[model samples]
Target: MDKAGSEKSIIALEGWLQTPAGVYMRAWEQSCLDNLTADIFGYNAVQIGMPEIDALAASRMPYKLLADRKPRAAREQQRAVNLTLDYTELPFASQSIDLVVLPHVLEFSTDPHQVLREVERVLIPEGQVIICGFNPASLWGARHVLRRVGGTSFLPRTEELISMPRMKDWLKLLNMGATQSRFGCYAPACRTEKWLHRYAFMDNAGSRWWPYLGGVYVVQAIKRVKGMRLIGPAWSRKTAAAPSAVPATNKRREQQDG
Candidate 1:
């Protein structure tokens, strides 16, 4: 889709988050968070985009929220946290954040690369970044298709759902190395049975072998020091090559004699 269309789609999706379909999507997101490691525990972590989820996750860590606005429920929770500071221009100093959880913000951002760079700028060396987003090529996408065709409740114009490889490339571009990745939420479409939902792990074996096929993708990356120059360039050598030794001119002696 065109850039304008993509932006409209994202806005529509954000609005739809309050709908039944959106609630299910958010539930899936929370499920992803439930599976996250406690590595952020006791660390100065920053959660961008979703204040409600951040508020809950940060309860375990020295956490803060950075977003465009504050959720009313989050404000009511009074989670001992800061709120609504622009993520694009964060208030924290360089290398201030110990961890960052990007809960599908990049997919909706106008400049995802810039956001990643800002994330890199704030993250401490070797700091972690956990990203969660919808997989473009997965069962989730198939569900989206059903939602469209069957006229099932769904938000129109969800932004460009990026692929896992593209997301890895973005991390690499920002000097973050992928440490681990996982996929979850394997519940089949049209199967609303609670047992079926609980048995989603039946697909876990396939997920282990092909994680990219799952509905949602989660990736953890660590920032690394980049572009250090310990040694000078080879061209900086001072010595020049000496010309090949030439035969002594015997003609000079013959000329003197003449």
Candidate 2:
């Protein structure tokens, strides 16, 4: 889709997320909470999503909220913390935050690059940004196909389902060097049989063999240092020296020519 169309689609999807299917499709988000909590245990972090996540992080470390809308309950639940702000334009000063957790934000963002740039802007030099995304090449993605063909239509059409490689490229563009990446949710997207679902945990074993096949992928990247400029004089300083004032230069040239 074109840029404008893509933006509209993302906004539409964001609104649809409040629905049941949207909620179901996004259930994988909760699975990453454990990882996020572990990573940001004692840092000034920002939870950019539903308000409930703010409360979830309250007991552990200092965290603020940044969502499109004000979550009244979330605000009331964490009354002591008043750091709520807009995601597009954050209130924090440049390079102020130590950690930023992106739980399914890429999937729903109209402008993923802009969001990532904002993440880069708010992060301190060498700060870390943890991102979670669904793998389009996995069994889970295959299952999504069935849902689409079957007319299940749980959530708005996904704007973009990026693979790990693309995400790595984005990190490079934003100057965030990817330090580590791992996959999760190995279970097949569709459980045609009951046993398949029953043995879903077996997918975890497969991860040992084929880590990329996992339904979800997690990447941790550290902001890289900026490039430096070359410093030197524009012109050579010795070029201006006059050739030992040759008064007989013409005569010497005539003699050599003769």
Cα lDDT of model 2 overall?
0.65
> What's the TM for model 2?
0.64
Distance from true location, Cα of 185 in model 1, Å: 1.6
Error of 1 at 10 (Å): 5.5
Which residues of candidate 2, in runs, are more than 4 Å off?
1-43, 50-60, 63-86, 145-156, 190-197, 227-258
- Tens-digit per-residue lDDT, 220-246, candidate 1: 899998774479676655433222222
Q: What's the lDDT for residue 40 in model 2? A: 51
TM-score, model 1 to reference? 0.67
What residue pairs are clashing in model 1?
A: 9-157
Error of 1 at 103 (Å): 0.8
Best by lDDT: 1
Per-candidate TM-score against the hidden true structure? 0.67, 0.64
Task: Name model 1 segments beyond 4 Å from true.
Answer: 1-11, 14-28, 34-37, 55-60, 69-81, 143-156, 189-210, 227-258
